[model samples]
Target: MTLVNLATVLSKAKEGKYAVGAFNATDLNTARGIVEAAEQEKSPIILQFAESHSKYISLEQAANMYLDLATRACVPICVHLDHGENFNTIIRAIKLGFTSVMVDASLKPFEENIQNTKEIVKIAQSLGISVEAELGVMNAEDGSGSLDYNTMDDTYTSVQEAKEFVQKTKIDALAIAFGTVHGLYKKEPNLNYERIKAIQNCTDMPLVMHGGSGLSNEEYQQSVANGITKINYYSTMSFEVTNGLRNYLNSNSDAFLFDVDAKTIELVKNNIAEKIQIFGSSNKA
Candidate 1:
């Protein structure tokens, strides 16, 4: 019965000055590990199913698994749809009982992004669901062995535009691009802490950070200090699990499939627990 919407936990995070970890789960084992980590750490967490990953697990199937997990959990769990690209997917997520949804139209023109986000906000809010919208484009790993610092400014979220977008869309959270990208960074990322502070000053709501993996501890804490209240992390967790599986298989050539699943669950749980501690959400449940 601890299932709740995104706004509920994020509001507490804003007040407490600690960001909640919003981790993406592609399957039941990963989702279960995330919840177990939260329970062990006594922290509130967001379990996300991204639209891009719907190919591996359908939206309907993920919803059923996540809902079952959330209902039986001891701590608050927000089952969220991450990076929902279109109105149809967002609507389907709502019908499937997602507590929160993100409408990502950041690739569109400013006004178009606003209009698209607003439409979803209007619908989702009426049902007591929290909506999140992205204002700037996050770079994806292009195998360049480093982020193109030259184009960083071009992609960073404008402070003024953020204020307007929040006002118009009335979203519960905002994902702003301040130099982070999807997948592993080829080199150390030059995060824009100042930009985050400027946007926070204007919007005065929970701000979210995507591509939150592979940052140093200082970077993560600094982002929180600058007002990032939710961080979407995935790549590093996936990498760690893959490495763990490789090592396990190398040593145990006769390992059963159930044994592999058990190892994955253990690895995922430990990795998430470490992140919970870094996010300063431990014991905050």
Candidate 2:
């Protein structure tokens, strides 16, 4: 059982100049894909469930399922709650044994975001769970995965405010909105490398890059080099699974419908393995 806290793995990534991939898993197959990628590449990975997806899988179920897989795996893994908006859900995740939780009150006012995050930090730190909080709102206001980068130009993370936010909240990681949107970009994204470096200098906490799915390999490397220690990935993997399953259904005979799930898992595993390498986490377990 190699289940460890997010701080342990993320701290190592910070020191090693790499980023750990945090994949959002909506079902057991997606979870297995993430874990398999980490195990195969010898990389530490995080499996998380967003608040919106909790309706499909309960906190207890996610914790139990991932804990089981993590304990038996050779690589280090952490179970985390992604975009944790509701306090009740955050409490439930912690009580259910999640090793990390993100308090995403970015949409709220600055003071309110701080107050809400501080509350969660107090509880999470007491139980040795790492807390990650977002400072700026991304382009994805709706639940839809994609976002318009232009609409988010005015909302990039403020370096000075980030220092204060971290100091007040005592979070383990900070997810900054540095020009990247949540879903696939319709046009090429102009990532603010300068802003990332500025924020990186403001705090020593492991920095995170949201919307990591659509960037080029060079962009990913640059982000990691500039101090991104954790990257949340999902949009591309979700597309891969959906596309794979759809193709399988269209081509395969009725007798082979039952095999679609297995095929989708295989496709997800392949995609994540590539992502782990892109994030420079391969062989870092």
Candidate 3:
């Protein structure tokens, strides 16, 4: 009953001066952690399964799992397919009941990205599903090789183009690249606050900032103040989960290996709770 679509909640966040945390989860454990943390904090959360995760499971299976959890959850849960590339994948996600889908054709030519995203929006909005599209190029660091077409690694989202894209694509949210990458940053990347402000000024649509995991607290709050309504977080969650298990195994050795699952879940929950608070979504459900 608490399950909801991304647009409604994100729009609320836009007016409220807060940002919803979109956590990418690969398995039931991570999904549970995200939901539990959100419920405990009374924050609206987005549980997303990226297209890369489909390598191990089908879109139908992932969608059903998230839907089942969201239906029984205490707080709003938006099930999303993150960084979906093609029509077939997006169609599969929609058929499987994804509440939101990201059509990431940012690497393609501007006209092509617009056309592809527009096609998705046409279909998704008809089904009451919100669509998110990326405008700028971010280097693919996860070694997925899916973003090899992204030749403009240093390219940032054009403010003028962003206005036109929003007007043309009619997407619910726009993920703009403001100097952040996919994985962990080797150095502290400077976010273009001025660019973000410009884009926000030109468009009323909710803006999203990817590579949210490694940004400083000031950077996060600054993004929200400037008009970012949804922030995508993933690498930090994965890092915390793995680090928690590693520490647990090192301490437990032979006897308590099976208990690592609980510890991992706890770690993930704690990490998400902290992120929720940072995003200022806590108690905003």
- Assess the local accuracy of residue 21 in candidate 2 as a C-alpha lDDT between 0 and 100: 96
Q: Please, what's the RMSD in Å of model 3? A: 3.2
Candidate 2 residue runs with Cα over 4 Å from true position: 141-151, 254-257
As a whole number from 0 to 100, the lDDT of residue 1 in candidate 1 is 41
Candidates, ranked, lDDT? 1, 2, 3
Q: What TM-score would every model get versus the actual structure?
A: 0.98, 0.95, 0.94
Each candidate structure's count of clashing pairs = 0, 1, 0
* Regions of model 3 farther than 4 Å from truth: 141-154, 255-258
Residue 221 lDDT, candidate 3, scale 0-100? 97
Please list all clashing residue pairs in model 1, or write none if there are none.
Answer: none
> Which residue pairs come into collision in candidate 3?
none
Cα lDDT tens digits, model 3, 101-196, are 999999899999999999999999999999999998775456454443234435889999999999999999999987777886665566788888
Q: Which candidate is the best by lDDT?
A: 1
**lDDT string, candidate 1, 18-137, tens digits:** 999999998999999999999999999999999999889999999999989989999999999999997899999999999999999999999999999999999999999999999988
- Give the worst 10-residue stretch by lDDT in candidate 3: 144-153
